[model samples]
Target: MKTGVEKLTDVMAHFLGHTAIRLPDDVIAKLEELRDKEDHPLAKVIYRTMFRNQRLAEELQRPSCQDTGVSQYWVRCGTAFPYINELEDLLREATIQATFETPLRHNSVETFDEYNTGKNVGKGTPTVWWDIIPHSDQCEIYTYLSGGGCSLPGCATVLMPGEGYEGIVKFVMDRMTSYGLNACPPLLIGIGVGTSVETAALNSKKALMRPVDSHSDNPRAAKMEKLLEDGINALGLGPQGMGGHYSVMGVHIENTARHPSVIGCALNVGCWSHRRGHIIFDKDLNFTTDTHSHFVYEEK
Candidate 1:
């Protein structure tokens, strides 16, 4: 009989494998909506091709892109959950198995060694971030496949107190103007403002896990999202960066109270694919996921 940790690992591996090929419904919907909004002839063709590509990947049961990307998980674990102690090991094993089963692109090359791990598992690969929840027995996981191209344009900086919020706006506008097209626009832009670079950077990436249409809760932050969306779309990079009226699907901002002397801001850009999913597991190890709710997994 399998241990609870083993069971959770197996389920998560399968979930990650499926996520590579089948996009979430929300992403598909957004892509379709963007497809119709395109005025440029070639841009329309690109969107159509994108749709067809997704269909073919699903039907063929293969990855949607050759660069399946480095795996990353954001985990919120209830302190009362039984498997909390085992999550790190469970996630690592799952990622190793998924690399072969999904046949993910062997993207993890050791920097100093200059050789591929060939299994997407390395010292820090498939990085996991954790948040502890009080008084609950369920764990929620957000998985993201961060492809190389999409990860290329991520930027972060600390702003002097004098620069103000407008500094953040300028920083984002400058980055997008310079490299936004590189990440395959109609991008989902995530902005994080915090007291330091690392916090801001982490929050920026977390913001990407939110649904594309969702906005920040803080009114000030929400307004910033709107302004950034409008400013980016006005760039006319459009679908696949071939030039069109819409350059981004949405802008999201996540923020924390910052030091009075400094403001740190970061940007994470998700391409049109926006490959991510969410899953929840109870203490019993029974699980549910929004990304692949239709598919049933059998325990061994």
Candidate 2:
């Protein structure tokens, strides 16, 4: 018989595996939209190949990208979650199990020792970020595979207040133009604005969790999102950087009020694969997922 945490571990492992093999519905929809907007034959061919790759991935039940990326979890848990105390360990074990079950590529290496942990659980492998929800028994989890090519050019800096929001635009555009092509085209861009480098950097990653077609709740931020998306598409990176009519799937901004003197901004990019999963769990561990809604998990 499995313990409560053990059951949760199996569920998480299954979800992680599911995430590796599939793209979210929103991402697929946007990709199809881009494919239709292009007139270039090569771009059309590339888009077709992309879909074929996804089809093969699902048919074979293999990861869509060999990189598979570093497994990271963004967990929003209620304070009253029954298994809250053991959640961290549960996640770590789940990652290890998924690494083998999904046959994921080993992507976690210790910084100085420089040895791959192999199990996907090391000193800080499978990085987990947490949020506490008050007076609820439900938890929301986002799992992402942060690939090296996409994450390599991630950057952050603090700007002088005088530079203003326009400065933020310049910073993002500069990075996208310089490194965006290498990240794979039709990238999902996440921009974070806060009071410091770390804060902005973290928020930038969180922005990637948003739906590709969604806009910010704030009107100014929503406008900025559209502006950035348009500017990036204007780059004409096309599919696989071969060049096309559109360059990005979308741009998302996650911002927080900063100190009066400084505006910190950071950028995180997600490649075409953009493997991530969103799952909500009740206290009893009954879970539902939107990212891989079509997936059928095998019961332990």
Candidate 3:
């Protein structure tokens, strides 16, 4: 008989494997909109190629990109959940199983030791972040694949109190101009502002998990998202950075109260592929997924 952790691991492994080949519906919609909006001939061709790549990946049940990327799991767990103690181990085992079953690119290598784990699991590989919710018996997990190109452009800074919001705009514009093109354009930009660099950096990546069309609830933050989106699109980096009218699909900002003396900001960019999935598990481990609703598992 399988333990609860083992059952959860099986579900998670299937989720990760399916997520690799399938582009979420939201992403496909955004790409199609960009394809129609683009006027440049080369940009149109690039968009078509992207569509073809996604179709082939899904049909063949293969990864869309050779770089499957490092896995990152963002978890919101109910304090009353039964498997809370085993969640981390279950996630790690799931990632390891998915690495081979999905045949993910060997992207995990030990730092300093400098050896590829081949399997995506290693110390700190498939990093997990947890948020505990009180008085509930369910858990929500968001899985993100952070590809090397997209992850390369992530930047964080601590702005002096006097630098204010303009400083944020300047920092983002500078970072995007310097490195955004390399990540594959028509990118989704997530900005996080908090009291410290580490807090800001994590929030920045979390921001990317939001729906593509969504904006910050705060009015000022929503305004900033618009301004950044417009400024970035003006850069003319275009689709795949090949030169087009649109450089980014959207801009999203997530922020929290910050210290009076400093404002820490971070940027995380998602490429056109934008691979992520969400699953919710109840106390009994009954699960439903928003991102992989179409996936049907074969009995082992």
User: Which predicted model would earn the best lDDT?
Assistant: 2
| Per-residue C-alpha lDDT of model 2 across residues 28-96, encoded as one tens digit per residue | 999999999889889999999999999999999999999999999999999999998999899999999
Residues 1-300 of candidate 1: C-alpha lDDT, one tens digit per residue: 888888889988988888898887778888888888788898899898888999899888898988899999999999999999999888989999999887788988898999998888887988999999999999999999999888988999999999999999999999998889889878999899999999999999999999888999899889989998988888889888898888898998998889999999999998888889899999898888876655568887
The lowest-lDDT stretch of 10 consecutive residues in candidate 1 is: 288-297
**TM-score, cand. 3:** 0.97
lDDT of 3 by residue, 1-300 (tens): 577888889988988888888877787788899899999999999999999999899888898888889999999999999999999988988998999888788889999999999889788988999999999899999999889999988999999999999999999999999999889888999999998999999889999999888899999899999999999999999988999998888999999889999999999999998889998999887888766667766536
Cα RMSD for candidate 2? 0.9
Cα error, candidate 3, residue 221 (Å): 0.4
TM-scores, each model vs. reference: 0.97, 0.98, 0.97
Better of 2 and 3 by TM-score: 2
Output the TM-score of candidate 2.
0.98
Which clashing pairs does model 3 show? none
Top candidate, metric TM-score: 2
lDDT of 2 at 209: 98
